[model samples]
Target: MSSAPVVVVATFTAKPESVDTVRDACKTAIEAVHQEPGCDLYALHEADGTFVFVEQWADQDALKVHGTAPAVGALFGAIGDHLAAPPDIKFLQRVVAGDPAKGQLRA
Candidate 1:
């Protein structure tokens, strides 16, 4: 797998009646996120009843900027009232893929 300084994987379960609303709410922010300087990937997927977002950033600073972006706030405001529960989010590091394990980081 390729390397990224920051990778985010998030999951959100929309209250059955709120899926469309959630998806629509995320459009603006996702569009703007794709235009950000260090955003290598910002893809959303739907499976079962959950929405998932996978993101890659050039570095930590870039990720931090995304946290404060205007579109981000707008997105939350639009969807905040409809989420089934709070979004499940995490920052990850790729350590293994397929059949191999890569070297570990010491820091």
Candidate 2:
């Protein structure tokens, strides 16, 4: 099987009173994406009202599909009114597969 090619790390700070709503929306998005064909992992974490989304996809194409999915679109739309600032997103290429100390780097 091919390894996941793209990993996305996203950070969002929710408005104090809207934290629960934001988290619920993010959770729904994660659940939706996790059911898609090329999604490897979809996780959401929260700390002090800040939500972090981490996802692993088969490739760029899969990531693109996730980005355009209705659930994701709706989540983004809903979060806009509850976010402290725009979400921060970063894409990474996996260089290691197992233990950090033992895994080989891609380059």
Give lDDT: candidate 2, residue 45: 88
Give the lDDT of residue 35 in candidate 1: 86
Q: Tens digits of per-residue lDDT for model 2 on 1-107?
A: 43546778999999999999998888878777778777877788899999987777877778888888888888999899999998999987656477876762221
Instruction: State the displacement of the C-alpha of residue 53, model 1, in Å, after optimal TM-score superposition.
Output: 0.5
Model 2: weakest 10-residue lDDT segment is: 98-107
Please report the TM-score between candidate 1 and the true structure.
0.83
C-alpha lDDT of all candidate models, in order: 0.80, 0.82
When superposed on Cα atoms, how far off is each prediction in RMSD? 5.2, 4.1
Error of 2 at 97 (Å): 9.5
TM-score of each: 0.83, 0.83
lDDT, residue 71, candidate 1: 79
